[model samples]
Target: MKISTTSSVLALAAASTGSAQTTTYTNQSAPFTLQIANSANASLNGLYLFSCHAGAAIEGICVGGSTPISGASSTFYYNTTDTDVSGSDDGQGLLVWNLPVSGLPGTDHVSQSAALQPYRPGTNVVVPLFGFDAGTPVHFDDDKLTIKDYYNDANYVAGQFPDSTPAETVYNNWYSCWTGVGGGYTYEALSWVTAGVPHNPTCEKIDVIRTFL
Candidate 1:
């Protein structure tokens, strides 16, 4: 690429106003692997990896701390273009994922809660794994499964809801059902209707997926 004085100045100015977004979970103290699943319920435009962008509607989160209960960092990127994302234009989008280099039989992961919050204004997005995708490659522990949803319908699920949640919460809640089936893990399928949320789920098992993980 050639650099010009006037072009350089404009480029720098534009670069100075973008955001990098990322979301990190409480890293397990022990070495653990996850075939994390994601649901867009929207588009991949504001998607972030390990940071946020200045104009990015959505930002990435960071994860740190020690096992069984780790912590994540806040969004951390600025002054960049959404199309500039690695995987977006080049074959480098999955920066957050290790890919081709991770644990085997990658444990399944679901996002009950978004890694972070203040999403691009919409309904709760989730990808219920009613059944594992058949005939597809087994996603690596670090492999990122894109959660692309563009038809923003709040009442998309069977229970008709606007009180959406994130994938992390979904995973955590399901994890709570580690012992058995039926009543033991019933809470994993619970959802609450806020006073003015405009939606109500009497059964609460709306986004909850019942299957052997």
Candidate 2:
């Protein structure tokens, strides 16, 4: 599945399904591999993975800290956490968003469309995670995943800061370019929304196959 927005386009591809899928259970550790194609023509710096299950949206568990995404394609791994124990009990669906590389302050550079698939732990495969064909292009300057929403909706918290605080407001003001603190304010502003904004999740791809790394 893919979606196109006014300013940008997003993409996703199909994967395997049903009994061919294996569940990753609690207390088990495994590495899940993913690959992304940068059709947006922008360099990405991070990846935000989310899990949708039980009528609630939760942050998915990814082991390694994010790295830069560039070139025709990029590969990364979900190296952290016990997948089965962490995902929602009702269902295990995964969605992905790309964070573009930017130096602008108050610019929440997140993808607008999401790449989705069912969770199958212990599978190592190269999945064409996201791009312009599946979803809308991300607009960091406009579509924002607010810090308050992050705290209110998901289990992940922004740093050690309280879910909602005056500091967060200030940080968002500066991050969203509502203030004139300038580009140097990146670090301090980031302190406010530590988990960062997510994509709109307007698209999905099913039956994705797990590739062996």
Lowest summed lDDT over 10 consecutive residues: which window, candidate 2?
A: 173-182
Q: Going through the candidates in order, what is the number of backbone clashes in each?
A: 42, 26
Candidate 2: Cα lDDT at 17: 15
Measured against the true structure, the TM-scores of the candidates, in listed sequence, are 0.18, 0.20
Using TM-score as the measure, the top candidate is 2
The segments of candidate 2 whose C-alpha lies over 4 angstroms from its true place after superposition are 1-72, 75-85, 88-94, 106-207, 211-213
For residue 44, what is the lDDT in candidate 1? 20
Error of 2 at 57 (Å): 23
Candidate 1 on 12-40: residue-level lDDT in tens? Answer: 32233211122222121222222212322
**lDDT tens per residue, model 2, 1-213:** 111232222111111111112122122223233322221322222332221111111112221224322321222222112454554223222223333423324443333123322223432111222332232111111222111212243444656654454322211211110111121111111111122341212112111112223
